[model samples]
Target: MSDATAPQPFNKEIPTDEEGKFRGYAKARADFLHVRLVVAACGALIIYIPHSWHFALITVIAVCLAEALDTISLNQSIKRLNSGAPLRPELRFSLYTAAFQALLFSGVVIGGAILQPRVTIDMFLICYLFAAVMNAGMLLYFNSAATYLRLLIYGITMILIISMRWMYFAGAPVLAYETAATLLLAYIAFRVIDFVENNFREQEQDKVNALSRQKSMKTQLEVYANKERHLLQLAAVAKHANDSVIVFDKTGRITWVNDAFTEITEYPRDEAIGRRAGTILNGPMTSPETVAKIEHAAATHSPLRIEIQYYTKSGDPIWVETNLVPLPSSPEMDGGMIAIERNITNSKLRQSELANAMRNAERSERAKSEFLATTSHEIRTPMNSIVGLTDLLSEHDLDPAAREYVVALQDSAQSLVRIVNDILDLSKLEAGKLKITPSVFEPGHFFNKLDNLMRPRAEAKGLSLSIDLPDDLPLLYADEGRIRQILVNLIDNAIKFTRSGGVTVAVQGARIANTCRFSVDVTDSGIGISESGMRRLFGYYAQAEDTTSQKYGGTGLGLAISRHLAREMGGDLTAVSHEGQGSCFSLFLPIACTDQSLEGIEEVTQIPEAPTANLAERTILVAEDNATNRMLMSKFLEKCGAEIVFAEDGQQAVDLFCAKQPDLILMDMQMPIFDGVEATSRIRALDAPQPYIVALTANAQKDDRDRCLKSGMDDFLTKPVRKVELLDTIYKVLADRPMMEKPLS
Candidate 1:
């Protein structure tokens, strides 16, 4: 292996044992001093030995040599440790000291045995054991080898003392026995000393740990004190803040108010205290709901923010956005509420201005709709008269040129009506008032109707029309009229644009979740659209080109209207085209399939038209405010075999209806005094039998129709109604319901 890849040496190990006890230079030096101290103290006991002076001098010399040797060894080890060098001290120093000390202890006992044997042996045992217990265990207990060697030397010296007393010194057997018993006592004392040293070490560790915990607790207390001081500072800031701050007591009574409160409310803090917040601040502009919300938030221990109106001491109203903060109950402080209120009078004024502007915009929109409806009515009323008169003139014999002129007039009038209808329809769509009413119908019949309607136009343009429907297609659930209208617009556009070739409409279906998605692709071989022309093709009032618009003479709204209608039915309309190949438009609709067994699908059965009733027997009331409209209606009904009675206003209509008691009443809305709704309501509330009431109004909005129906009118019809529709509604209402089971609507 290369040197770069070789393993590195580890860092030096700590000078500590498994019990985490430190045996470094400082501890070793302390041990050295302690050993010397024990030696000097033992020398003082030499007076008790036989030949006290000699024994004392010899013990001092031995102690001095032992202390010098221990000091030299400890100093050498400390130098090695300080210089960061590995220590290799000789163990002979410890071995020699233990042996020399043991021998000195033996000599003292032996000298006593050789002279006054009984007394000195016992005194010597007492002094030696005491010195061993105090210093021997502590000095070298961490060094196992030295500790064991010292213990061995003590045991051997005890055996030697026994021999010297009894076997060799002509001493009593009791002295030998006393020496042996003293050895046993010394062993037991060492055992006790060992236990005491361990206890001391444990006490030292516990003291360190206790000091660490105390320091940590002191730091935490200091941090808590700092935080408490910060809170006091914050309270001082709040007391002098510029925003009004009111403190409510447990009973919802104001207990305190900041300087800002006095400045804003024009009331001194002392006077504001002890008063209810609502009683002090609430005025004509204050809302009960906002007050209730504050009380509710306090009771529930939640916070509430509201824009509140308050009157000052000068009785001038001001708006404020107030936050009610609920305080939690605790032993140190009673529970209450703190309301921090910021003035928002200018903001409230700006909001009022915005609200007024929105109201004006709404009024403008309503006025626009009214104007459109009224204008449409005025135009259509005369247009209806012209169309009806033209129809009557067509039946008379005339020259070919005059008849052609009349036909042209009829077509032009019809075109104008269609334009008006489109404008109204677009308006309704933009206003989101056009609602889709869904019903179940057979797909085969639905497509068949479109096929029949487009076939003649397609053939007239020298193009073939064909439809391809899947055999397994089920009955569909959607707005039948809307789907039919969208398809008609698509198919008519296809026929109108294509002059040659053919148009093919293919119906394909696939199951999409619970519903089936049907795509009707209408491909036409016509003048294909360019890329730029296709970009805005489906936009409102957009056509393929200026030339196309000039030549075709159309509103260019068909595709745009068709696409929106398709989306409102939960689908979309898409188109794909090539420059020369032709254009294909696809209408996709996702409609649910109906269960055939349930027979819930509505059948397209035609209602038979009711026959005109006898005019001699029937009496009708025509309540129209417009003179021309009233005259036009009277003539139309007079021809339909009914006696017509006219009312100029709603009040007049009500009076005529009650006086004549007509079989039916045709009422117009937006009249003087009472409107159609009030008139109808009054007629229905009469004690007599209620006659059939039908609304004939220039107000063409759905809201108008809904109001008419809600006011007890049986039927509603927009103004400028066709002669056939008017006659039909009249015949149907007057016809006997019991004879027909249900009158045709």
Candidate 2:
């Protein structure tokens, strides 16, 4: 048979729309059969009457009508099923069949009552037995094998009922037949209930299986979708990665390369794959050590990092930082390494350029030092002549006009000295030779000294200057000289910059936990710095880009030096300013307590009067390498009541010290033959009384002081020294010494 016409298995066949219609028709036929049987049984009730023919006719007519009604109901049910309506049509047909059967039976019984009652009753019982069998047989055809057995039992019940009817008519016992029929009916009812229960349970199991299959299908679809999305995201990341990525097997054969690798190497995927890693990429510039490291990583199954030079397809050498990570092994494939390389050529070039720039900067710094030294010497030489001439003029009798000119010269010389000092201080700070010496001093006493120094300058400018100190401020731990220099620089800057409003210096103490902090705030109505200017204000040699620099000339190193000094003394200086408003600069320093004995040391209450011209009695040893500086020092000391002895260098001074045993010895720090530190060491080694040793060196850094003290020098004094500083230092050292041993008298 062709596939379209072939007989299929019962389970495989597609249910036709006509199948339900056919079932409806079959049920209707069964109902009709039952009705005909019931009608025939009723006809038996009128069979023996005197008017039996009329009763039989009425019974036949009633039976025909019931069968016709049953047929109509069955046709309606079939029509409903064909239209895809509910099975309730079949149930209505069954009920109609039962109702029609009862009507037919009733017609027969009523018609029989008009004839003979006894014969009619006897006929009705026999017919009922046959009709019951026919009804049960029809039920058997449509239902199960059990239903067929029920039909046979119902046939036997009909026989017993017929027997019971005969027994009643023939005067025989009826109990046995009636009891047998009742038992058969009960068994059939029980079997029907069992079949219905089994059918529902099977339907429920099928539903559960269907639902489970649907859920499993949905889960598989979701997993597939997720996997597709993840693959797409990975492709995007690999395509856009900035670093070159290449995967290779342990045998060195390239397996894969990302888009960056292709772009960087200028090698297409087809050209690069299956080639040895070193063959295509590595060139003369590539390091053998780097290749060896990669080989070691592949052998040991570890990660490796190395920087190498590689030539691109365009023949440009690029520096690359490469990382090789070993892939985990799998059953289907051998382990390999994934190489991620980043081009660092630009960075490498920048580093080389920076190194060259640093060398140039160092050379420039050295040249600057030499220039400063030469310039300082030359300028001081002229300054000495000018000052000396001014002093000589003051002594000589002169007119008011001539004396005024001399006074003007003196003021200019003093300004030049201040500028030169600021430059020297800045140089010391830049050379990293500046050092801090912590000293215990009363805050009140320190402020008093600052006031004495600044009050005159403020009064000259006609600007109010006030110093405010907290009463409970603690002693400061700092280099006293450096602190004073920082304060003077800040205050001087405030005074010089301010034209109208006054300048104020306020001192306060902050107690935090175990430490006391001392702070100095300097507020001035100066031409304040702009936002753009403030950024570079603290920078070396930087000045405000306004009228301030043009109007009030300065070296621009004071604030920078002050900030450096403050930081060196374990503090910091910061400023707040507005363009048109005033400015406030604050200095924060850690404070300590003053020792009692040190406090008892009497303050110098007065500037000592200059001694008379009696240099014939006093001896001064000058240590100087420069011939001009040596001559200048001798002349200056000769005018200060001392006879001079000179040494060209530190070593000469040491040798002359033991022979002359002069009252005081001068030391120059930087010398060719022997530096001041070494000469002082030799001088200190002598078993004689330690002479008064003083450092007179061009190196004015605070480290110079430490070096001097370490060498057993009694005091430190910078070169190109003012006559006042030199004379004051000499007199103080002499006065501090115990009275010189008197000769035996």
Candidate 3:
């Protein structure tokens, strides 16, 4: 918490008057010396006045007694001032000293009157008045205020003395002396009055200046009070806030802490206060770099924002964001820092989760791309042999049993193509690159399509497949392609996993909401997922069981893609299953409301079938780098009754084509001398009849195909060639050639 008290002023030296007790003693001794000198001067003046020896002696004794008493009072006053007590003792002593001196003077006057009976009383009276005036002046010198009061008191004494003098000397020669003495005394009184008046005026002006300064200070203090109140309110709010707040001095001491700080650090304010901030809060896990940064900020008076790991009171490490600021007003004062710490442990954990998600996404993408490339190569390799051999077999008269076996082979090949295309579609959907094309269609038609697609697979698995569509179901305005993809993936997963149970897809609800939800539940009696497996069931490439790779074969991306698509369509896909029990997968889709009549949904056309015929009369050239692939192509093509010529690389193929004039060339990419792309370019540049060129390369990436096309190849073919794709491509290229230059003739 922020400190509430204002800093004390910096004092360098002590005042001389308040230095020590000994100074007070020195002051008292100085006053005593002055009083003694005054006494001696009075004695000398009395001796010159021609008084009797006894009178003079008595006068000396009186003066001596007065001085002694005054000295004692002064000493007492100094002692009281030094002791730091009230001025009562000093004032009382001063008053007593004044009284004593007054009595002494009165005695002198009375004694003179009694001893000098021959001497007119007027002379004695004049001498007494003079002594009174002198005493009053001495009183004024001793203490200013006391002196003024004494002067007034003694002025009345002088008046009484004058009255006595006038009565006694009215018929005596001493009247002249009395008159002179009275004039001088009156003048002295006048002077004392003038001096006192001036002194009083000076003191009054000093009082006015003092009051002015005090009033200005009061105004400033009022402003300060308002500001302090505001700051106090702010401090209270900061102290009560949920975030832990701590203030540290420039020396790194924990000067203040809020309630929240105590709650977080588990250290009470009393225990934390005056302790070093680092010693209490820092632990082994705390970074040295963070500590260095805090020190740098304090030393340089810079504000800093940093995130650090700090141990809580329970010794648990928690992440905190600390905002440190410097107080710049007082460099000499301690506690110049404001530290506010907020718990960010949850946020850090969330950030970690997101980072892991991104990494997983990247890995999934790489896997999909790899799968596509590998599958392309795998499907096409055998396809070339099948299609080529089938063409060769078509040329011969074959038994009916042989024909049936060939047909089966063709069916299996087509199935593989369909599976590859499905995988590709799922990959596109997962990548968010699949486009949606919405159309008005009957919900029944959608179900029928699903029935047709999955009925065969279900029959193969010896499982029943059913669909439930309410007659009242309205037309759904949704992307037919996406909806079909979702159904296909879910039903396929059900069929693949279920050994005996049937798969059911049900559709319901077409009300005022202008939408319909189709629930596709595929229940299987096969092995169900475990609780731990369910956690990652919807994750990409995560199978339902640990041995899924051995027991069931799948890309594991089906459910993941289905869920993503379902969500994109403003619906969701969920699953419920238990170990050893059947699993139910449901897909919910929002119905589309439209006034138009539902029409039959169109399906994409299947690949055209190739005519079975032998190309033995035609001559073909094989250009390949890999020896195994080259031999495979040679054997397969020769079995079709075609005369075959081989080239180890692209450059050889180009040279052989110019000499042999073969009907076609199967080019391989990644060769030792020259690759397929270069060979194709060189072949097209030749003056001779350009052989029907087809790229048969392992570089199956999309960019690779574009490059092959740009090189003037008639067609692009990925490696591990399929029999059907190779033959179909050959026929297409040959069909487009000019008949006048037909090499087979």
Candidate 4:
């Protein structure tokens, strides 16, 4: 009944309307089979029909034609519906009236066959029984007018036939009962078909739903494939990036890497993947601490941007700035970091070079300072004797010619001492160990003292000396002693370089916020500097000209030392000069000022007399390693009326002091056998009066003086000792000690 477009295998998941149409199609099929069954029974029953053969044949032909028409109508409707063509509801099945009329005619025809005369009891039962059996299929195949209605028509017709043959069937009631039993069997079959048909419909629906889901899944797979293609494009970009990129899994294994990673690390992608990132790159140069740090970051899920050492596959060391970023979501890797590295080996090399240069420069500077200090100390020891002997010779009753030679010799020794002192000062500045102490001083009185010192030298040179002190000048808080040194150097240079013109000492002042600017200008009207000469004027060992140091008699360090000292005191020293004209060297000091007067300040005015150790009363130990210095001190002390005892080293000094119990000990700090400090401690430990022990060494620092005092010394003095200054210190020490009462008076 299905057309060409119909499902060859019946579509199981039919809609409610489609199921009705399908069942109607089945009914049309059953109607055709049922009509054939009835027609065959009609022929078979002809023997019982006797004279109604012609009537029976005509009745069967009429029933076949009617059923054929109704089947044709149902089949055409099903064909249109299955083909997805328009199917009118009116045309889908035969009019219900036509269907019922066909059934009525079939029933009439069946009744005629059963009721005809000459039908025996056996004949009636077989025809009726065959009709009921054939209709059984109709009950299962169609929902309407098949099993019960057909059986009722047959049963009622037989009962009427049985009444007509009452005389034949009256005694044989078994035939009637058999007929009733056949109708009952047909009703049972109807219920069975109806029950089974519901289960069949549900199974058919499940199959259709499964096919629909399969079609949808196929579409989804296509979309996923397109997304996979896009990801491949992103991978191409990563493959050629300059920086090395690698991804790690949560367990620290490499899951993916770009082509640049392989290029920089000298390992291929296949070899790198599945390997621990740290283990693969961690060679001898790579620190274990770095690996542990990376592992810790992974464990804690942290990000890192730092530099670390890495090695190539061939074991060449290099530096890298590694950047680790956490991969919160990635299909290939679990939660982990992606490390990007850039090479920085060149930068590391440059930094290493700079550090080496700095260390070398420091070492060279230290060596220079040490050499200068040693040379100064060695020269001072001998220089002390020459100056002292010359002074002694000058004081004696000598001839005029001998006295004149002694005075010239004294000048030479003093000049040598100044040069050595300048070298030591320069070294101290370079070593960053020079100490400056600021104090308040009366500018007018300080200038008066400087004037008196320089006036005689200027007068001898036939040059005028002038001092200009400003009345409004405030008391200056500065290193007064260093200031005096600078002023003296400038004034002395002015006097030494000038042949005819005068030297002027000018002091000027100005008020700055919370401070005063004091400019002391030593302007000399002689031998001026040229433009090129001023450029290197304040540099180490620099002079106005090459011949300036030789001709003017200087070590060429005074100006350099002066400049550094001025800056150290929060000021500067600068020069302004013109060729053949006078040079003005300005000493600028930013003073922490005060308005205090100098009324109460007392000056030491008493003439200083050298200490006298009465020969019969006092014994003094002189611990000096140098023979010249020892002889010089002995002659000076002998002149002072003191008996002299000599020791070559600290150990001998201790022995001599213990045995002789000297009234005083003059200790030299640096000696071979035992240093002065140890010898002084041993001498002070004796059960006797701690005689005044004076430290005389070449170390001219305040810290050195403190060290001597802490070691039980009574007084401290520097080497290249001036005759007057040395005598002054000894007299002061002896006068203060109770152990030397007679010597003090």
Model 3 worst lDDT window (10 residues): 1-10
279-310: candidate 4 lDDT, tens digit per residue: 78877767788777877877888998878898
Which stretches of candidate 1 lie above 4 Å from their native place? 1-212, 215-222, 225-345, 383-418, 452-464, 496-503, 525-530, 537-561, 578-582, 596-675, 696-698, 718-736, 739-745
lDDT string, candidate 3, 195-276, tens digits: 7545544555565677778999998899899889988998988989988888887677888889988877788999999997
Candidate 1 clash pair list: 615-641
| Predicted candidate 2 versus true structure: per-residue lDDT over 131-195, tens digit per residue | 44334333332323423443444445445544445555564444445445544644554464345
Worst 10 residues of 2 by lDDT: 1-10
Q: After superposition, how far is residue 98 of candidate 2 from its true place, in Å?
A: 39
| Per-model TM-score on C-alpha atoms | 0.60, 0.55, 0.38, 0.60
What is the lDDT, from 0 to 100, of the residue 419 in candidate 4? 86
Task: Please report how far candidate 2 places residue 469 from its true position, in Å.
Answer: 7.1
lDDT of 3 at 30: 41
By lDDT, the better pick of 1 and 2 is 1
- Backbone steric clashes in candidate 3, count: 17
Off by over 4 Å in 3: 1-457, 465-489, 504-525, 530-532, 565-571, 578-581, 588-648, 652-672, 680-701, 704-745
- Candidates 2 and 3, the one with greater TM-score: 2
Query: Clashes in candidate 4: how many?
Result: 0
